[model samples]
Target: MFDRKEMMEAFLCEANEELQKLEIEILALEQSGDSETSIKRIFRVAHTLKGSSAAMGFDEMKTLTHEMENVLDGIRQGRLRVSTELVNVLFACLDALNALRDDIEAEREAQTPTDRIVERLRAIGSGEAGAGGSAAGSGEPGHQGEGGGQAPFEVGEQDAAAIKQAEREGMQAYECLVKLADTCEMRLVRYYVVAERFNSGGQVIATIPELHMDLDVPELRFLVVSGLGEAELKAKIEQIMDVSKVSVARYALTEAPSSEPQIAVAAAAPEVRQAPGAAPVKEQEQKRSSQTIRVGVDRIENMMNLVGELVIDQTRITQLGHLLRDRYPVDENLEMLEQVANHFTRVIGELQESVMKTRMLPIGQLFNRFPRMMRDLSQNLNKDIHLIMEGEETELDRTVIEEIGDPLIHLLRNAIDHGIESKEARLASGKPLVGTVRMTAAHQENQVVLTVEDDGAGIDPERIKQSAVRKGLLTQQAADALTEQECIELVFMPGFSTASTISDVSGRGVGMDIVRNHIEKLNGLIDVQTKPGQGTTFIIKLPLTLAILRGLLVNLGPSTFALPMGSVVEIVRYSTRDIYTLKGQPVVKNRERVIPLLWLHDHFNLPRRKRTRDHVFVVVVGVAEKRIGLIVDELIGNQEIVVKSVGSYIGKIEGVSGATILGDGSVALILDVTGIFQLAGTPKKIGSAPDAE
Candidate 1:
């Protein structure tokens, strides 16, 4: 019943976790030179990955991890030191491991080459390159531990006590020396298998170099407290492949053998022991593991679909109850039906919320990936930049998290390449030598607002205007007429970039526009705020979840449409007298801001309804700084609507993002606020205008 596919998937998952931790710890180690804790963590992660890869028969991954483990072990034992070059080599190893993991996940085998990285790791581990600090102990495996002359298999007080307690329980303590074949390529893996065999029969008190230490030597010694006699233990060790010789001798507590050269104790036993009255860590871990299980994303999506169906049905039942009450006025069951509908509505609402919550994940998952990227970028650009992140605990829908990573990455790259000044320039400008780019996420009502701000040379509006004109994106007159904010907005224009030269990082003029498009596709908003000399901040606002949303349904002639409430700033009943022409376009004045008015009937090519009253309802919708007041014939009440994609048969509509089913079973197109703005074109003027109503 061995499930190879399932085992590979589990290995892939575990590898990803370990690799992420290694990257974080490696960066920390570089920051705080000679951090023992970070070194140990890095060593542990590499060792875990080495063991897992070996078990899965991924030779490439196992080899790479084994070399990485050696290098990390060297650093941990203080035989090697951390340096910039050493850190870069470690990062290279990490990148190789990631590629290997990706290959295994996709092709069921690691196709990435690890020979070069392994050589580099070996070079560093042997003190040949990029390695500093004392070059103690011949760099060979099983050399006496730090500050030589202590016994290699020496047991600590706690381990000796455990051995004595096991002896009292009728178990015999024995010293087992297992020697590997001279041609054994994976000595560590072979040792691991031997250790597992010992632990299966009885407890392994300890090992000579310890499990995580250097295991490249020909021989490994294990202190075992087992009920199995010497013959049984020797037979067990002989069964393992690549194990050349096995010798088991009864251990005497009184004497230190003079025949064997004494070596220092490397590390304590790997087994964790708990204090009195405390729950065992292994038991607690098992309890925790039992509490949670990995459920696939597809299952969650299916559940969400089912919830959407329930919501639709619930809406239908409530509508049916309203009809029953209104038409059949004092029927006996109408009251009960009404009560049941109300209760069902409550339950469905709760269910919808719960399902959406299941889809929610903290934004930190996305934010944590940026620091390492920032580090590499800063180094590449030769700029002194510090990236500060905040509000990572803010939660967003998993779907949103998946989509937002690319946009944020583009912004960070632009921040480093275009916004942040170089060290010399910063000094000349009287700013700090190290530029800081801060990324923060927070919950703003029903939306998640993320901002990436950089204290570099704030984007120059004049330069943007000039670039726009030079690139033929705009006429000189047009560019000159645009205000500073509008000039900055020009960056999002297709094929628009302010960089004088194109490079690998950016400057081909293909990033910002795509960033904006991706955000809009999620029904989100991205805006930029900049000052001349201070900094620039790109703010993105996205919905908490896309599966369900509160939508404002409106009537345009005989057709109904849903405007996402996230984009709907406010609804205003404007008097015909309040609407006037500003440069031949119908405009409305709301709170001193002039917003262009659009007729949905004209946009959708439907017949316009004549105004029968002096006032009109305008649903003001906006994304970022742009606002357009959409004129509707009638205002339908808001409701929770399930979003459904329009099938490919109908293709993509211009202003309609998607469609949602109503209580009456009719489909209403969900209006895309960003698309509507595009269809509306750029507004001409926003100044005071004469009322021509």
Candidate 2:
């Protein structure tokens, strides 16, 4: 017996892959009408899913895919045309398949009903609805055995001799015609079931269509040599699922003997019609699959954890070597120890990189899902949207990919519902009839930058200010005082929305705030830029991996806190005389920008470090366009740190993202820059500060 659980897992994996391919091809077929390649690919995917589902005993999936195969076969044969209505039905089938797949994945059996979708597919296949219009090949004849005709199969000379021999042995030859119901599902499976029953009592000499499963023949003709009576054979055929009529008659020699064997076969199965390049493609795919194996996410995560530990140990060893060299300045043994530690550090660094790469995956896996979503959303809104995606090959850590999806989804949804102008509005504005939403991802320095931009009516800062004030999120004076960029940032404020009405799509004053929150949790930044009449763009910058980061370690009295280097803008040493009071808030001047200064000691309830010099060290950290200067006791330089979760024992901290161990084995809290900015609230203006030079 096979491992049933493993079998299901494999099936689910393959099913998801096939479904994704089907969706892409179906979309292509819709876009490039009459694309034979897309049609054939779609048909092949449906056929594959049909066979696998039948083998796995997923009756619902088997039945649904069979109907899908039938419809696709009609389109492939050019008997049915591609149209918007037909494409909609195909998309509906895809949706149903996804629902069924989800059910199977969760419960180990599909519980979603596929009846409605199956009926629609059958109707389209049978030309009752959604056939659009017949194509050039509609005039061609269908299955010869399906219509009234003489027995569709003829026995060969060898079969004739065998039949005669069988008769002499008290057997009889019979011609069987089986007619399936028009609404029958999995007609080929039913045909095979009846054929199996016939073979039980005797032998099936030949089938009209050469017994190919890919053929969508509604009627079957068989020449059987058996001892069973005609009534027994007819009863067996009728017992099948969709067999409507059966005729079993004793065979008679209708022609004279021939010198050579004579047999009849219908046209070769549709599988032979595959594109000429398919073989090479299949060979390449086989080679690729042979070289790779699927490892579970948990296993990769465990490897990453081990690598992280090695990194920590490497750092500690390197630090200890430095300590030994400093204490024994001229010792030859310390030189050797330093060299060994250096080599060990290099190896550990390489190992860490390799492990991290294992957790990286192309963003295409997530981007591929959006086209279908855009199709549905555009249709629902009665708008025309062309979504262009680029840089799908850019890779990011799987953890980042997982966390980033929801935020991306929120942005895209808002792009459609709020950013993109309606068709009429676009026309009035002299823009193109169809709006464009472009999503792109690429590596910038050590981070991945993803942008979602729309060529729609851009955001208005004045409107945003008004909305902020109207929603009671800010006072009128406060709203008016914000700059254009700051006004645009109000979209990320909770309970702030400019939409006059609420709908299912958006306008609930929710998404943008959550998007910002999610990105910040990943230690990333989200910013927006817009022109009044042009468009809007949301840009997000995220680290390549969240497991480790370069941190700027700072001392707050006896405690040390690490600030992510990605958010560290710059460090400035300013004279104490430059400090001024801005509405009771301490402010410092860095270049020309007025930065509010915060005391970390006060925030964390630690003892304040008294200034020992005329100059004070100020670390400037930022989230998007907002910057704040953090006052610390001392600067400990920058180092690579492995981030560790704070755990449930301490629950959650306000300004701390997580904790990391320093080279000295002491734990340092990693400051959440975005959270610290939030804790500081809005900065006091420099124009309002007293003692300003």
Candidate 3:
């Protein structure tokens, strides 16, 4: 017996893919309203969805997409032009389809009412909606004129030549019309039956309006240059189920046979037929390039877990090999162990790379949805903001991708709401009336840098300071003493809003702080840069993968800790003379900048060195725009370490992100740079580390 559950899952997967394509093509149509390619692309997706829904007995989905197909058909035939109203309605249809899909996936009845969207589509398809221009080909059944006994429709030059050559070869040409059942549930399948049945009898040279998956219409016209007589062709087609009638006519290529050929009056307009050998081979290759199979995400994640285990085992083997080398300096066994260890390392390295690649997906999957979002946002806010994206092909780990999506959305929304200025303001400022928000992703060393930039009114530090004071987030004196750069950084402070009036979009002062927190949780960093009249840019740096990271190992007395190498700037030897107290806080002047020097031992409750050395090490690290000097007893070299989470019983230790096992089989706690800053003090002021009491 067939697995009905498995089959339904397969259908849902395919349905989601088609829906994604539908969204992309609709956005393309909105941008390039004259693009026929995008129009046809959307039509094809809707047709596929309609056919599959009907096959699965999903009447609601089938009906919705069927109506969508009618509207797309009208657009394809040039009867309806792309308009803002049309785009909005299409977006509504897309949303409704997505809701239906969600219901199907959850095995629940679809509660979303699609009647309004269907009625709107019907109006546009039938030319009743003013948005739909003139009705060239009405979206109605039986609109396809008579074909048999009438002259065959005009064909392309190449096809015309092919038909004449076939006539000279003693083959008679007949135009056959196959009228399907008006209420046929599977018209696409029944139409395929007619095509297959007639093609088996004789070669089907050409078809009017071309054969496609859309079956909203009731009739089909095929021009067959074959040996079968007209009566035999009609009899064979009528035998197919619900094929109401079949008409056939013999045509001479030399002159008009009798009446004008059947002009396909259906929404699927008539097109000149191309000869058999006239199409480019690239078309077939293009179709083959897009062929793919869907796999469950759980399976991919399971594979990743197995690969992670192998990596841990590889680390242990290397450690064991090192111990043998140290113990047996002159033994031949050590050499053999080394060889096996090296080979194992090579194999595991390759295996790890392969598994990681599977988990790496192009960031385009997340970037593709933003265009439509910006479109709606622009209209709703009346800002006329244009979004530009770059480096969408940059790949990241799937876990990172999923975690970064919400933060990125928050940043984008904040950019549009706060960073970009209004049309009048931009014009007054001598800038373009339409603001531009550029979102770019690029790989920088072992990290991915995503930047969202906007060209509009730049952030004013004074306003930020005033806003901070008004919200009681900081004292007026504290806000006034902050440098312009520190003042601008106040946006990330909790409950900091610069907007004078609250709106539905933003001004709640909630987005940026949450965005910063979320990114920091993923072992990522977010920074902002703004110029007085020039615009603002938010740059986020995230690790390529979270499974493993390059960390700088440091020692505080006997306890070892791992500092993420991405945040470590440099290590400097500091003597007593190099450190001084400012406002009762340990401060260090490095490169003409005042930075706080915090002792790591105080935060972790670790012991400090009893005998103070003449010189101590200070590891300078930067998180976002804030710099801090970490006082350590010793500095260890950097190494690639696998990040393992701390157990749930001791969940979320302050100043500690996770733990990793070192090569010597000792667990080292990974330090969280952002958390360290938070533990010390706020962003505006860095207080002395707490005493270990």
Candidate 4:
């Protein structure tokens, strides 16, 4: 016997996978209606789910899947054609399946009611529902009657043979139609009870829409092959509450020279028409090797923790070597120690790379879900949107991928709802009727850059300024003082929006701020670019991994700080004579570019060392396109540092991202480049100051 808990978990896992596949397949079918392979795939998934649910004794899931299988079977047989309404019903059933799966995970008895969705599926299958498909969904007199509504039910040669053999074994076969009251609640449960009654003494050979809940048609047909008489079956079904009617009919079965293989072949119908390209696609898929196994995230995280410890120890050992060399010069023992430290350093470096790779996952895992989401959103908003994705194979740390999904989703939705223009507006502007939103990800230096861009109406900074002033988020004077770029950046301010009215898709003004917060928390930054009549693009920059990074160690006064090398553009020395103030802010010219210069010690409230030299070392770092020059006392060179979070006691600091232990056994604050840029009040674009009035 199988462990019940293990079986349930396994079922849940497979069921969720099947449901997701069904969603993607259903969407594809809706787009390309002539794909025979997609229909067959959907049918097989539903059939397998039905069998699994039956085995697990999850009667509700089994019953709902039985209904889905009937519709899918009709589709596969070409009796029912694909339509928007049919695809919608299929999606509805998928949602119901998800709900049932969630209930199972919650340790509830799989009791999610699926009667309404089951009815809709049955109606679509029987031709009583859908646009221009049928109007008799209410089961009124004008609708096609039961005999003429659908193709006549016929037993395949294999089924006829089996029926004849059952008769020879002294079993009776009865066909019964059971109708229930239209107003009955918990109808699926009631149907399950009735199926159980027949299953007790006789086998339920088949059902019309296959023994689901009380459907919209108000009737169900069942075939039972058992020793129980027809009257007995009828009486048992009638005893089920809310069963309005039951009619039993006896049919004769004739079979001659039928073999098991013949029956099996007939029962398992071969695909009548295969898409021309499907065979090669299937062959290619099979040829591709699946050389991977699913590993739990916790296990990978544990491995990462061990690697992190190794890195810390390697740093300490290197520091010890420095101390030993300085104190015991020319000692053979110290020489051996140096050799061991060097070898250990190389070994640890290789170990860290291997462990980090294990934690790396392609960003495509998050990118693939957007197409379906965009399709649904476009339909909901009654707009035409074409979403294009590229560079999905770019890999990032699993932790970053997991946390980055929500922020990316917010950006995509914002692009669709606000950034992309409506179809009518697009045509009026001489643009394509179908607005396009493109998402791409790639490695930029040591960081992964993900962008969401659309070719629709760009942001109107004037509108944003006016909105800010009206919402009291900024005074009119402040709003008017903002440059075009600075006014657009107001979208990231909390509780600031430019929409005239609240909309379901956007206009809440909460999303952009949340997006920025989440990205900053992950040591990432979000930036936006807009043109007056073009469109908007949001660029997000994130490190490859959070566990370890190459950091440029810099000293301010007596304290040390680590700046992520991914954000460091270059290091330059500036003389005091070259530094000047514009609008009371320190600025410097580098290669004819005017860049803001900031003193780090002033922000951290640390006492600055009196400079004896006329020149100061400036580290030029940037987040997205905005660059800032950080003035520090000394350059301590670059090294790999293990990132550790500051204890919760102090929570978050203004410019500090996290803390990392250095080679000298001192904890250095890792500067959040994005935070510091924001702290410096740098404009998103250079020379973006408001024009003089």
Q: Whose TM-score is greatest here?
A: 1
lDDT of 2 by residue, 51-163 (tens): 78898888898899888877876776667889998999888888888898898888756777788888888888888884555665467645434333222344444777887
**Candidate 2: residue pairs that collide:** none
- Candidate 3 lDDT tens digits, 73-165: 677655677888888898999999999999998898888898888898899988898765654554533233454222224454466777766
lDDT of 1 by residue, 163-194 (tens): 86776556788888888899999999999999
Ordered list by TM-score, greatest first: 1, 3, 2, 4
TM-score of each: 0.81, 0.78, 0.79, 0.74
In model 1, where is the ten-residue run with the lowest total lDDT?
A: 256-265
Error of 2 at 265 (Å): 47
Q: Which scores greater on lDDT, model 3 or model 4?
A: 3
Which rank order by lDDT, best down to worst?
1, 2, 3, 4
Give the residue spans of candidate 2 off by over 4 A.
141-290, 682-693
lDDT per residue for candidate 4 within 1-693, as digits (tens), equals 759888887687678666767777788888888366677567656766777888888888888888887776566545567777777778778878888889878988867779888887778768777621543233333213432233223454356667756655567777777778888866667777777888887777677676544454566677777776778878878888999888777856422221111001112222223333234545645543333444556777887888887888898898899888898888999988989999999999898888788787777767767777887788898888888889978988878988999998888888888888788888888998888999999998878999999987889989989888888999999888888888988999999777767888888778999999999998888889999779999999898999999999999988999998888899998777778779767788987888887777777777677777778788999876678898888998888888999989979898889999876678999999888887787443222111110
Alpha carbon RMSD to native, model 1:
10.2
Better of 3 and 4 by TM-score: 3
Question: Model 2: how far is 410 from its true place, Å?
Answer: 1.3
Worst 10 residues of 3 by lDDT: 256-265
